[model samples]
Target: MIIRPRPHWIHLLFVRRGSLLPRILSQQIFVLLLSCAVVVVHGQLFHWKVTLTSAPFSLMGVALAIFLGFRINASYDRYWEARRLWGTVLIEGRNLARHALTLTGGGVDARPFVLGLIAFAMAMRNQFRGRPRQEGLEGLLPAETVARVQAARCAPALILLWLGQWLQGVREAGHLSPMLAQHMERSVDELSAALGGCERIANTPLPFTYTVILHRSSYLYCMMLPFGLVDTIGWMTPLVVGFVSYTFFALEALSDEIEEPFGTMPNDLALDAIVAGIEASLRELLGETPAPAPQPDAAFILN
Candidate 1:
């Protein structure tokens, strides 16, 4: 996610963004240097040669690769599920706003109110991620509702409360019939469900013990690898261990970074941009002017 122009020294920086390759390599280099220093000082390091066909390492390497692959795949599955839930939010959001406009039969001002409700969904999405956009949100809501919603810890819940109030008011004003009100309420319920699903995915992570096991095993394997190979490879053991460790650590770290897609990490699903897209769609459905454009930073990585 850190986009530095390709380093002039290397033709390709591996094209593997968001990986821990750099950090892993740096750590391995440090350890290798320390080991080299110790061996140089002892002068008895030549006796430590290891066999290339060591059964333990070969078997362990195969098992380790399989585990790392499984972990990465599972992490990606979680990330994608979060995205799919949000995608449902986007679709339902547009439908909700449309339902309000067509089903409510309120006047011109009411259409803006409906558009505002759509904006609230976007604001709530951002708020859940601990990123409330000050300008966009404040510009979208009634001052009193905004103040009250801001005061509350749960922004999405506040949005639902306000939405319920709006629907009730319209129903009372004779703009929305009982049947239409019921239909709109169903849309709100769907939105609420989407919110709950997102929260569940964000809150319930892969088990701590499982994550710890993989992480600990990865480092332990890398550490022991050099020791086992020191007799045969000498100083070259470090280079080999460094490369192998970099691959393992890079995959694990990348998976961890993206596991919680609601987070602010670069690889996290772009909830803000996605919400903005939903807002734009809703506004277009309502035929409103002054609709905000989709995010300019959509080019940034979100996968």
Candidate 2:
């Protein structure tokens, strides 16, 4: 997602990167042309005057706007919740890494378990995006462990499993106490819950029918809008309709982008940045001087 400080008021008015303008430009153009055609034909498709009037459109348009508002609200709820879940990810990752480091006390080799935490973050990010397993972990983990986790159906879950086994072995070897092990177990459980929460949002979207209805209603309203206003607005129907069409089209497009917050869209959650932060912070806790943090794109987008 685009991560930048706020801009000036004038810049906000014209800012294009984080806005829905890019996605809805084609739709806006189509609506503008449709409005122009209605104006040319004088709101009459053939010779029929289209039989559409301002009264019904005004009533229907209000209802449609309300419906669109609800859709945007729902999408924002999903977006905000996804963000909170990932916040939990960051907190719990730090907790896990710190606990493991202290438990090992520079004797039991904490790097492997720390490496598992890093792998879990990477795997979870890829899983949320529905991408295949990632590479580049051969140097951090044993080749066999890396290969096994990557080949698993859910790579993040597999990494957690390996971490659990390591924890159990440490306890059995009398290196870690049961109470501290249980604390680590609780942190791992929280990690698993965070994963499940992300999966829920990624897999379960707003119903298809709801989107279909909203899309059809938006298009119909925008198309017939000119016909309704052509009588009162006269030659200015195209200009007025263009502005109104932009509002509705932009809302619809924004709703679609934010509804699924785990994707690589400009407005989706910044999984890449979040994962990088987790990796770097965990390594620092393990007393390893890591490289610089991740950087955003030219547009300040993290993903």
In terms of lDDT, the best-performing candidate is 2
- Clash count for each candidate, listed in order shown: 5, 0
Model 1 pairs whose backbones collide: 48-231, 49-231, 49-232, 50-231, 50-232
- Give one digit per residue, the lDDT tens place, for model 2 in 132-214: 77654666567888888778888888888888999999888888899999999999999899889988888899999999999
The residue-level lDDT of candidate 1 at 206 comes to 92
Candidate 2 TM-score to native: 0.92
Residue 258 lDDT (model 2) = 94
Model 1, poorest ten-residue lDDT window? 294-303
TM-score of each: 0.80, 0.92
Question: What local lDDT does model 1 show for residue 161?
Answer: 79
- How does residue 240 of candidate 2 score in lDDT? 88
lDDT per residue, candidate 1, 248-300, as tens digits? 88887888887877787656777766776777777677675535655343233
